[model samples]
Target chain A: GESVGLHLPTLSVQEGDNSIINCAYSNSASDYFIWYKQESGKGPQFIIDIRSNMDKRQGQRVTVLLNKTVKHLSLQIAATQPGDSAVYFCAENAGSQGNLIFGKGTKLSVKP
Target chain B: GAGVSQSPSNKVTEKGKDVELRCDPISGHTALYWYRQSLGQGLEFLIYFQGNSAPDKSGLPSDRFSAERTGGSVSTLTIQRTQQEDSAVYLCASSQVGGIQPQHFGDGTRLSIL
Candidate 1:
């Protein structure tokens, strides 16, 4: 079945550094994409999202880049903090129904 | 500032037993969703319900898994004849009218099948 996946299963970064997580999606017809952060014992929290019309979207200290041709999506966190560490998932909405198909997620660990 | 709320944060059941999980979506939210997550993994889509519309149950793992939403506000996912693989965190989310809207998620229910 078609699904989204992450390039890195685990990422370790130092505090105050920048971290980048990458995702590859298979469905070409997807129109919306979103990033979510899940902390331990908690539900997934919305981080950032981008539409097919634009190639990039920026949130507070977070940026999402989309490359439609390659079906690649990335999340960049600036000045990474310990609290920023979590499992990050990228999801794609293929149609107007808004049903999201999620990626396996990448565990991000920040070393202080 | 009320978000989605789920009941019985954690549940422990024996194999072959039945369990029901509940979700209370954000007030006036017209869309509701259910997902299952294994430990250290991504979420698996379960079902979706739009106000007064038929639910999408394409993701239910087997015949034992079922869910229903009443009055477009509360939803319950029922699992019959549970097994060890049924243990996971069940998450529910809600959105505005359209699928283009961002989904707001609840804390989730942790189920452990013994």
Candidate 2:
């Protein structure tokens, strides 16, 4: 198992502002990256994903940026909303083994 | 259901009791995974099942923990002689047919060992 870490444990933002949650991974061989948002007492919901070949991938209101060089990944949420508040986690897959190494996660709090 | 489903949303048992947790994956999905999340901690890989072949039980914490998938549709995770440290949320997830695909998770079964 590889170590996936987060730079921050918590982030608070106001409405309409952009939010950036950073993650650092140790497995350089990881080829796939994904971001998941989990609400209280619920399972993780897929937000966005990016392959190692590409540096960035975007989805509605969210974007995932990967830096293979530094083994770092970040999820950016545009126009933060109250509904966007949750714990975000970054997961990485080294290959086709189907095992995703997960980070400890960062709690995102969006203010109304 | 459109997403993965798990049974026994909450379980409380005495120490040394054996319990089973069941999971019903989405139809036609051949890949299933089980993970454990401790309090204030991240998800920990437990076991993975692909199709009908031998499951990858490397992530299992000890011999007391085991899992099985029947017909590649439903899965059951059993704990033998439950311990106090075994208290945690057990989550089950399913993916298309390969590891590269995204995984859909269930609400998870909250197991409390008293």
Which candidate tops lDDT? 1
Model 2 chain B: ten consecutive residues of lowest lDDT:
B49-58
On TM-score, the candidate that comes out on top is: 2
What would the TM-score be for candidate 1 when compared with the true structure?
Answer: 0.97
Candidate 2 lDDT over B18-97, as tens digits, reads 99999999888898989999988889999888986545778899999988887879999999999999999999988888
Model 2: interface root-mean-square deviation in Å: 1.0
Q: Provide the RMSD of all predictions against the true structure, rounded to 1 decimal.
A: 1.1, 1.0
For residue A51, give model 2's deviation from the true position in Å: 0.9
Question: Residue B114: error of model 2 in Å?
Answer: 0.4
Query: Residue A108 of model 2: what lDDT?
Result: 96
- Angstrom error of the Cα, residue B50, model 1: value is 0.2
Q: DockQ for each candidate?
A: 0.80, 0.78
Question: Per-residue CA lDDT of candidate 1, range A24-96, in tens?
Answer: 9999989899999999988899999999899999999999999999999999999999999899999998567
How many clashing pairs per prediction, in order?
Answer: 0, 0
Candidate 1: misplaced stretches above 4 Å? none
User: Could you tell me how far off, in angstroms, the CA of residue B101 lies in candidate 2 after the best superposition?
Assistant: 0.8
CAPRI class assigned to model 2 = medium
